[model samples]
Each structure stands twice: as structure tokens, then as C-alpha cells.
Target: MPQLYLGPWFAILMFPWLDFLIHIPTKVLNHVTPNELTLVGTEKHKTESWNWPW
Candidate 1:
């Protein structure tokens, strides 16, 4: 039985995907800009869009 049966290898194979799934939230949140109350912040002056250097 030990030689014929195999454990859940799919979970092991899904390690990278699981890691990405866990990391995407942090990545998206890292890039996200919350609402600002002052004159200058991460977003543009007039619009709600984010400001990029490029």
C-alpha cells in the first residue's frame, strides 16, 4: 500500500502559485494610494489618478 499510494503532490507543486497568490495583495496594496487630506500626495493635483515619473 505504501508503494502504490501517493500523498497530495499537487499541493507541493502549487507552492509557487500559492506564494504568488499570497504576494499579489501586498504588491497591489504597495502600489495603491490612499485618500489624501493635504495639498500634495501620491496622486495628481486635480485628478484622482496616480502620478508616475515616467
Candidate 2:
């Protein structure tokens, strides 16, 4: 995963002391929108909407 690689890269450049301990989890857990992660692509709906027509 690109996020996995980016974590280390970012840590080396930004925060070497913390290293993977902080970077890895943040990248894995952070809810970065697909639009920000991709270029010229659309995100697919992964979860069903709860728009109940009551």
C-alpha cells in the first residue's frame, strides 16, 4: 500500500524520532478521502446509505 510506504518517507523527512510508531497507524487509521488519494478517478460507494423512505 502506498500509505505504508508514505508513512516511513514522511517520518524520515518530518519526524525521525517517532518513526513508524506514529506514522504507520496514523496513515492506516486516518480517514483520508479517496479524492485526495487518487487523481482522475471516482470513489466507489462502499457502504449502503440509510435514507429510509418512511
Candidate 3:
């Protein structure tokens, strides 16, 4: 049907706008500093450590 076809067509056309919208928040809020990089290891010291607790 045209409605079903239109849905995908609209989504494909709008994907870049949607992606830009999604990227803004992550670009703004997901940056880490040099101090953060240095303190990334060791879960005992940094609560936000990139380690799996086991």
C-alpha cells in the first residue's frame, strides 16, 4: 500500500535529521577530560571506572 511505502520513505528521508538530533546530546555530555582519563582505572578509587565488578 502507499501508506506503508510512504512510512519507510519518510523515515529514510528524515534519518539524517534524526541522527543529528540524537548526536547533539551525546557530543555535549559524553566528553572526558585528561584527569578523567588518568583516573579511569581501578574501581576502588573511581566509582565510574570502566571495569566490570566481579
Candidate 4:
């Protein structure tokens, strides 16, 4: 019974961190997608590219 209660509470506690994790890329993309922008505008650093044939 205690574990069951903790499970939901833990999820609730983690919700903000989860939301932050989800929010970052959307914010990053918000800059990238606009025509006046091109990249993350952070650095000349390297990144991995993902390719999907679909």
C-alpha cells in the first residue's frame, strides 16, 4: 500500500523535471524552425544527425 502511494507521488514529483526535459528541445526548435534562424545558435560544436527514410 505504501509503495503504491509513493509511485504516484514520485511521478508527480518527477513531473516538473520531465516537463523540463520535454520543453528544452521544443524551445530549441522554436529558434531553429523560424526562417530567420538556422541552428541552435549555441556553438560551433558537433552533434549527431538522425536520418529517417520516411
What would the TM-scores of all predictions be? 0.33, 0.23, 0.30, 0.36
**Residue 35, candidate 2: how far off, in angstroms?**
12
Better of 1 and 3 by lDDT: 3
Question: TM-score for model 1?
Answer: 0.33
Query: Please, what are the lDDT tens digits per residue for candidate 4 over residues 1-54?
Result: 686778788888899888888988789988886777456666687888999899
Candidate 2: 10-residue stretch with minimal lDDT: 32-41
What is the alpha-carbon lDDT for the whole of candidate 1? 0.71
Give residue 36's lDDT in candidate 4 (0 to 100). 73
lDDT tens digits, residues 32-52, model 2? Answer: 653455465586769977998
lDDT of 3 by residue, 1-54 (tens): 687778788988799788888987677666643235454556565467588888
The RMSD (Cα, Å) of candidate 3 is 14.2
Which has the greatest TM-score?
4
> What lDDT does each candidate get?
0.71, 0.70, 0.72, 0.82
Show model 2 residue runs off by greater than 4 Å.
1-17, 31-54
Stronger candidate by TM-score (1 vs 4): 4
Ten contiguous residues minimizing lDDT sum, candidate 3: 32-41
The residue pairs that clash in candidate 1, if any, are none
| Tens digit per residue, CA lDDT, model 1, 5-48 | 44556666688788888988787876786555467557646658
* Residue 38 local lDDT, model 1: 68
TM-score of 2: 0.23
